[model samples]
Target: MAYLYNTGYSSGENYAFLEAKGLCSYIPLHGTYKGGPDGFKYHKADDCYTCPQGKVIPFKKVFFEKKNHTKKKEYRALKPVCVDCPIRSACLGKSAQEKKFTVTFYREGYERNNARVNSPRGSYMKGKGQSTVEPVLGTLTQFLGLRKINTIGIDQANKVMHLSAIAYNLKKYLKFTAKTVKSDTKAVCYVILNIKTLITLQIRLLTSS
Candidate 1:
């Protein structure tokens, strides 16, 4: 199955999981996602990042962030390397330690997903979602009183959603039928007016003769 999601659902781990499950995902990266630091080159085989100053920042360890519980790989350059480097001030910005950074463990999956997101097929899928899915969702949330489900169980929520969809479809059908009837009424009025005009013209002609 294929899934199309917006930037809100974009994540390296999510991409990796979807790929592992043999599902296609077309999701745009969030605005804050930079993938990696600018001017840094990642070496896949070496499992390291090369700084702009040609120094290697090797992978140190994989750890989970306590606050967000995200798994990340830490890379750190040698302390001595940063201490004597000519651009140490510019690179580290008055820091007391070596160059250190953490990247998502699923960086490869992120790269692959990003590549697909920029492809033509992905663009088409995104456009299709905007035209077909997003508007309906907006209507449901904004107009159909589905912004929040007050029910207690999944079944109740599902029923509420079904009722909202039915209401939306019924509204659309009523609008279509209303327009059809309005046009039919105008047509009938137009024909009667023309007949009356013709009869009036005939009466005038006979009286004048």
Candidate 2:
């Protein structure tokens, strides 16, 4: 179809799901401020992340969130890394402990979606959504059976939605076809009548002469 225009669509969720499915190019979203993970560099070979101050923060642990069942990797820098560093004030900003950053659940997907959201093509799609898709969805929800699905379970819900969509498309098709046929018929009748009138005028002129 056309570009997606979901105002309530979560970039994090979208990115994570798509990335997990290996559908899109993933790029992490970095914060431009001090104490942000974007300032750090990840070392795959070393199995750790390096801070802007050159401190090596090794992987501490991996934990799964019970609610979402997603795994999270935590990294922690040495306490001495922030101590006595010239830019420590700018990096830590008076935090008592050492620097630590977590690669949370859906990190890949969140990053990829974030990149798409900030890209030129993404922006164009966003604009198109505001102008087009949103209104269509609004119409469907308001006027069509899409307002609510009475079915339970994913399969039932999917079937209901498909039926609703079919109904809407059929309604639109009928209206469009009816209008087209009416206009075409009117045009043909007007042309035929004009031709017959012209022929009659020609015959009368010849008779009068």
Candidate 3:
């Protein structure tokens, strides 16, 4: 089975693509944390979230995020309740209306990703990456002029990255090809000698007979 190892750059689209390719990915969420905020806790039974100050924010509506094309559930507190609350200043300062928060409607994918990342195997993979891939990337950036891309637009950046990867792989390919050719030559000679010895033995037996 194939696995994709990456940092936080992986998006929902990336995850979907990997799934389509039948490969599992070990990537942290784009953001440090999911859900609304530190103060808000989701209540599944009531289908609402309880704020730090014990105020309930009920579900308002479900909508799709246009950018990622993912369904989201929007929750909000009543304008009157928020307006009169003592902690309104601390919760949502200078707001004339109610407080609002949104969470993904299809959360199974995220939860599954979280579980994979928190597992023992995931931790080992992360540590291995830190010791191997991260250092190589660091070296490339520090010495190979990959620290910053002085280009604009995603297309240009992608082109530059492809060119860089080509150059890097070409160097490795040259080194690998030389060694492989040498080993192959030695193996060919060894097989040819064995064949010659077998032929000579057969000729001797025929002559003796």
Judging by lDDT against the true structure, name the best candidate.
1
Better candidate number, 1 or 3, judged by TM-score: 1
Clashes of each: 0, 2, 0
What residue pairs clash in candidate 1, if any at all? Answer: none
Model 2, CA-based lDDT: 0.62
- For candidate 3, lDDT tens digit of each residue in 45-71? 888888887888999998989996877
The C-alpha stretches of model 1 lying farther than 4 A from their native spots are 153-155, 180-209
Residue range with the least summed lDDT across 10 consecutive positions in model 3: 166-175
104-173, model 1: which lDDT tens digit per residue?
8888887788888889988888899999989989998888768899988876676666667656765555
TM-score of each: 0.79, 0.60, 0.56
Q: Estimate candidate 1's alpha-carbon lDDT, on a 0 to 1 scale.
A: 0.79
- Kindly provide the TM-score of model 2 when superposed on the true structure, using C-alpha atoms: 0.60
Sorted on lDDT, highest at the top, how do the candidates line up? 1, 3, 2
Alpha-carbon runs more than 4 Å astray in model 2: 1-38, 65-70, 93-95, 112-135, 183-209
